[model samples]
Target: MNGAVQAGYAPPTGPDRPAPGRRWLRWLLAATVAWAVLLAVLTWVSVRDDPPTVREQRNLAEAGPVVDRAVGELLAAAGDGGAARLVPDALRRGCRITPFADGATLTRGVEVLLADDDVRGLLQRVADRLPAEWRAGVRVTGEGPVLRADAGEFVAVQGRSAGPGRVRLTADTGCRPIGAGYRAPTAGGGSEAETATELLRRFGGAEGPVQVSAAPCPDGTTARTATAVSAPSRPDRPSLPGTLSQFSDGALHVSATDELYAYRSSSTVVAERADGRVRLTVSTVCRR
Candidate 1:
């Protein structure tokens, strides 16, 4: 080990080669990471949309009963008055309050959907399907069990403001006792039909043409129903007064009789006193 300056060159003490397979390992590691990221991205993209599938379509097709039951259940969630009280927003939206059709299968989009109890799609969708009269130009506001309706006149129900859409028609309809409760004179089963007949007989002074049909009761029964007798207006004919009353409780009562006819639904009642001279036409529902 001479101390003389070793400027010529230095001897290599350690191995001059790089780590064995080091580059290959790094390349393999990089490839693995890239593959992992790509897999993760692909997986995310695959699940992002999750659109309805063939199985879902088939399930929807087979889900007719399910959809029907769901709609029924949701509709049934309403109270005794009718669907209006049960689901006002839904009723206002587009939900058509109709007699539950027998044997009709419901589809999600094709028929109906229950949606969710918390979500409003059920009501929105139903509202979308309603006739123009129900949703016709009306502004609605507020919340909860009570609703309000204001158009030409201010109408409030339960406690909420009833929008213009709610004022045009009714949803909840139940049968009420009319005239003196009479025992059945005939042997036929006591029903809405019998009630309608008894009402006509008891209040027989009706001079105008009267029409009757089976009315669907709120309790899921159908009976004889009557509407105003209509005739073509003649130049000499006197215009009859139309009697209609509304109640905050969502009831309407109308009455038209030779002497007097009264009709009531929810909270409204209309009475027409004919006194045997003036022909009064009243429309209403009576319990069997």
Candidate 2:
């Protein structure tokens, strides 16, 4: 047979070729799949459930008993003045049950917080038994100080124990509330003149003594000696015009040419008047 015919008739065998690109592509795909699976697992783990409100409620419920017991102890210690301490806590916490019985009062939850679980349930029970307004008016006698506030007004009972003595209490009428607390004058017993002076200092720009010059006499009229009048230690603007004769009406009447001025020093007033002129005066009640 011819060579060409013989080669054509015989089956030819080919050499093997390496598939490196296909192998690399398979490895890359597997690594990508593994990374994707890891990310999905991490996301699931990070987003686990945590309910803050529910937890807070639970804590209150648990601490209810402890708080309730504390209230009882506080009331017993307070005796007649127990109501004072309870008022501030009730106002702050938003929940309290004050019950009146046998002419004596009992405080249940003035400071109860949601963080305690036991107290929360007790408070809820108290709420269910009492009317809503009762919570606002729960008064435990002698528990609070006069400075403790209620609603928008700051109620202070000055001279509650003054009997016949004079004591002064000041409420910063001009001061507005900041956050949960009011910007009232610091609590302490002082004469009304002193309190007024402090309020004026805070309200008005004037501080220290206000000095005044005496009228000068003509050269032939025997020139009067020059005199300096020290400002009144405490001055308050009164609801009504003060009596010109009396220095303190719990108020002061300032004039364009008046020699007297008022100021405050340590919740008290020190009045210094020009000789032959009336000295400043005021009245006050002592705190019981």
Candidate 3:
């Protein structure tokens, strides 16, 4: 009976005993832990040293100071001859946020209403006067020669000819969610405002639309500018350039031509007459 084996046989507790999927279960557990560890490592690698996810957000208001600083520096570099005014918002309906999301972008800048016909030279002067890190350079285009540079911090600065005697410089912050709209800084008429007004009166020009612009400087100071245009006016002497030449009381003559005049004393004052309109622009550094 002992030699006649049973239909099925099994070992009780010995080396010959089956572990019953114990090894498979242990392998499965090990594989699961390894996969989890790999996932954790990948995640850590991706987000290491990254800033808190805040949309890299900058609204028009937040970006105004940056643009103003750039514009101020640009005006300073362009000498005291060109008439400059700040364009707080240049992007109109075209201000789109991004390709992957819904948002808006704001661009701010200064427009040179009066400039030398030598656009190339004017652009070159501005390019050289700016911070060397800006990598400013002039490139030729069909419309005219243009100046472009990276003003650091993702701010793109560019200068181009707008018309026969017009040039514009801009610092653009590509795109961001319109966190907040721009609120222009409150500014009063600086001391130069009176001078600008006096010059206008000397030319028999009546004050028209006036725009005041302000920007922050790198030294924790603010630069301010005031611009006024006239309505078909003429000087007592009948010659715009000649009338300006006689104003040598305290201002240093910057430039004088048939259609334009510039003087700089404590502030830069520019007068340009074209198409029966006289435009006056005044700029001062660190006024506020």
Residue by residue across 53-75, what tens digits does model 1's lDDT show?
Answer: 33222221233223222222223
Best by TM-score: 3
**TM-score list, all predictions:** 0.22, 0.15, 0.65
The candidate that wins on lDDT is 3
lDDT of 3 by residue, 1-288 (tens): 866757697545567754868778989999999999999998787668543243244555566566667766786776454555555455544445666656555577766655356778788888988889889999999978999987654668989987876778888767655566655566664665566677677666555646777776555655677777776765444566777767655666545775777666666667777777777777775321
Off by over 4 Å in 1: 1-138, 141-167, 170-204, 208-210, 215-220, 228-271, 274-288
* Candidate 3 structure lDDT: 0.68
Worst 10 residues of 2 by lDDT: 216-225
Please give the TM-score that candidate 2 achieves against the real structure: 0.15
Better of 1 and 3 by lDDT: 3
